[model samples]
Target: MCGMLGGLLLSAVLIEGKIYFSETFGEGWQQRWRLSTWKEGHAEKMGKWQTSAGKWYRDEVEDAGLQTAEIMKFYAISASFEPFSNEGKELIVQYQAKYEKDLACGGGYLKLGPSTEDLSKFGDSTKYNIMFGPDQCNAEKRTHLIFRYGGRNFLKKAELPYKQEGEGLSHLYTLHLKPDNTVRVLVDLDKIYEGSLKDDWEMLPPREIADPKDQKPSDWLDEEMMEDPADVKPPDWVESKMMVDPKAGKPEEWDDEEDGEWDAPKIENPNFKGPWLPRKIPNPDYKGTWKARIVPNPDFSDDPDLYKYSDIGYVGFDVWQVKGGTIFDNIIITDSLKEAEDMAQKWKALREVEDAAKKNEDEAQAKAFEKAKAARAARSKENKAGDTKNEKKDEL
Candidate 1:
């Protein structure tokens, strides 16, 4: 809508988007989510999933999410939903994750795949259609955005940096995949990467390959600048960079054959010029570079529906975590960009409340530390004064 408001023109866009699947984990999350029984016998290595708002939040109910409840374990969990394909429409996959503890290594990502009859069997071996999220282990950190094609997973070539330092704070990870084969990756609503799938991923064969029959000629002069035939090295230029010192004198103890001929220690020659050659000019016979002529790749075949997914009925999380306190919530798969943006408002509000609360807590801790330091200093000063008085009395 466009109108004149107080002599100033204003316009507003009210756009809406469709939601394919959404999970808030508010109530009955256990019924909706299924935990994998991987390593069920190994009690020490198996991790568990719990729901909570963490230690701090503006609204605990709204902030509640599924969190990796233990440290140093492998956690695999998933949920099943009605299967649907993204054929001609745009696709948006977005989620919210927060690390409540220092994340030494882990993944906070999502996987979309086929619907399963048995949810208990979902594990690492299960296949997925799309895998997107933040993965960090020690110093290695990146958001994994991978797509499956031809029964193989192809990771995006573009690396999206993952921040492991923002502990206890929520982050938004969004991937916008358009039917046009372009993708936009965003973190906290800020676009980090935007490019086409055909260029950012090796999902297809090369359009052309080097022809085996084409070869460089035997006399092909490929070098742009070669030693000039007309130009020659200066006659005075010496091949040796060093020579016998002219000022050095051999010892007077003369023994011609017994001690061998006395030779002066070699020193750098000041008059000697280094290796010289003719200055390079443009080559008249350069064929640029002798390259094998490119021919159409026999395996090359274009896929018009490269972005389409036939069936994406299930979404799950399958990863290994050395140290884990990652909470995941507010996952949504939709056909509308505006819907994801609107959902991000919840995370933004949560962040504002968290920042303010953390600031207050830090200030209170600092004040208490300063007061304790002052008391310790005062006690030391009094003890020193008492010691001096006692020493004077002893002297009297």
Candidate 2:
């Protein structure tokens, strides 16, 4: 009995230890990414890494622009496992991350596996994202949450301040996977924005394969993974059909002309004022008083004036940190999209007013120029007349 039990335990351990794929920043492996490069079209920079005590470490820095709340977040991320293994089992994963002290406008996270489909019921759902950044200020100075779901992708999501009293560091996020394929995320460090859906969470079922028995294929596996033998009897018409050739690349007689290729238009950041930071979502269901905290970055000696309008073309900065303060925890549950639109509309109106003022100034300048030209013409005419009269008098 003891021998049998030991053998069973060994089998279980072997199965558990089997890794489909993995790449830790171990001895020789080095993977680093800049926190700033997450901007839509920010160009990627060369990565830097060092070896210490037989271990390898890489650091990624992003030039996320010079504006405050322009969160520059990067992660040394990796993904492994046989995606097409046809196994219907879900995975539970965990990892550790560390952030530098006074690392204003930054945070890190470990992302798990992702599906390649639009999981959000709304046709516009993203697949993966991670959050990071400084945790200060209310509704303005914010940390970051980055995600890429559906086809559209965005970076540096602004975090709302929900903490009130003490200073805290180090965050742990856990994912709970249910047998029903539902996944939930829990943030351990700060409970500001909790229980938010990271993606559409694709939970739809497949429709291809029919039954597992009678030579029928499983729905989990793709068509190309199925195999058939020529000599053997062709099974039922449904299951006997030859599967797509997985080894095939592009068709041999492919014609580029038939399918014209066009480059996607690249988007660049507008040369606008500083504080071009992400939008913040405010909680509206608060019951008591709330305070805003000013998160300081000691490394930066430049006064907040650097981001003032006189310096960057606009008056007030887009995102600003609190000099010294803290916000007490208050439950304000509300939607963010509506709030962001309201804020944007206000900005739009202000811009319109500025534009109208500028137009009026231009018109006034033009009118003055016209008046000066008219006066000069009248003077010239009078001088010419006087000279004609004098000539006439001399002739007489």
Best lDDT goes to which candidate?
A: 1
RMSD of 1: 6.6
Q: What's each prediction's TM-score?
A: 0.74, 0.26
- The segments of candidate 1 whose C-alpha lies over 4 angstroms from its true place after superposition are 1-18, 40-43, 221-289, 362-396
Please write out the lDDT profile of model 2 over residues 290-356, one tens digit for every residue: 2233344333332212101111000000122222111111011111212212222322333344346
Pairs clashing within candidate 1: none
**Candidate that would win on TM-score:** 1
lDDT of residue 208 for candidate 2: 32
Q: Candidate 1: lDDT over CA atoms? A: 0.80
